[model samples]
Target: MNADTRALLSEAFAIIDGIPDDAIRFGAPRSIKGPTLDDGTVCSPEGWLAQHPRFIERGLRLTEDGSAILYRGEGSASVPAALPMARALGLPLDEARRLFGQREEFTANPDNPLTDKQLWEQRVREVLGKAHSPRAEVQELAETGSLDPHFGHDVPL
Candidate 1:
């Protein structure tokens, strides 16, 4: 990555880290039963995947099958969204599988020393380290002020 891109990524990571934990609603594999939306669509757990696009714009991507999402900033960093979601929702891994079908294959080790936030930061750095075309495109856009600074709003990370 160029120096300018690295600097931009550093600033972006800081902004992400500064967000309050409570502002995020970590997803669970189990379907959350709730009333229909004003548009009359059922609010299923999978519906939550709709939030993935915002994350994608921030250099994360859901698996093509829609089973999992991970940081793509650096050579396909394997930061599974499921593990943290399971922790946040207090669901066991097995239960998560029962609900979501299967756990993502690229999950982090449970005994890893890093906290969730730290892991996230590490993944972000990894993604930034990669020489992906999209990252270059994003950097160009950012330099031109065509991309919003807070493009990750409501992203589930």
Candidate 2:
């Protein structure tokens, strides 16, 4: 079969989108296998994987499928549309601010003004519903002095 790189990218983006506050997918065994190099590295070894753009789209879709199947067909809810992608990924808060600054879509509002994360959460609630508000709250806490910056995401050892 011909490799549809674009389709693959779409799927990966879907996976990334499906997984909120995620750096990588869970439970999918990391597999890297292919050619060999001179450094005794099995060019493709255990947990070998691709993290490029095309693959990311597919990976995210794959996440949506698995999580939906296992969790009563529920999938990743729409995250806050305005929420900075960095916040959802647990990237530094500054990243969210910076990302928002760069987006042509992001605009200043005098009424119903939302901070970077608030704008994001508001977007998320519209699609995912109220249940996801906890995430938004968590995001809020992280922004304030009260919560640790690592508020929403799972910690990796």
Clashes of each: 3, 22
- CA lDDT of every candidate: 0.39, 0.28
Q: 72-139 in candidate 1: lDDT tens per residue?
A: 42322143454433333334545333332222221346566554444445554554555533344555
Q: Candidate 2, 135: how far from true, in Å? A: 3.5
lDDT score, candidate 2, position 126:
40
* Whole-model lDDT, model 1: 0.39
Tens-place lDDT per residue, model 2, 1-157, is: 1234222222223323323322221222222222221112111100111222222322322122121111112234232211322322333444334322322334454354444334433433443345533444444434554332332133221
Instruction: Give the worst 10-residue stretch by lDDT in candidate 1.
Output: 35-44
Poorly placed runs, candidate 2 (over 4 Å): 1-112, 136-157
Clashing pairs in 1: 73-127, 74-126, 74-127
RMSD of each: 12.2, 17.0
- lDDT for 39 (candidate 2): 18
Worst 10 residues of 2 by lDDT: 39-48
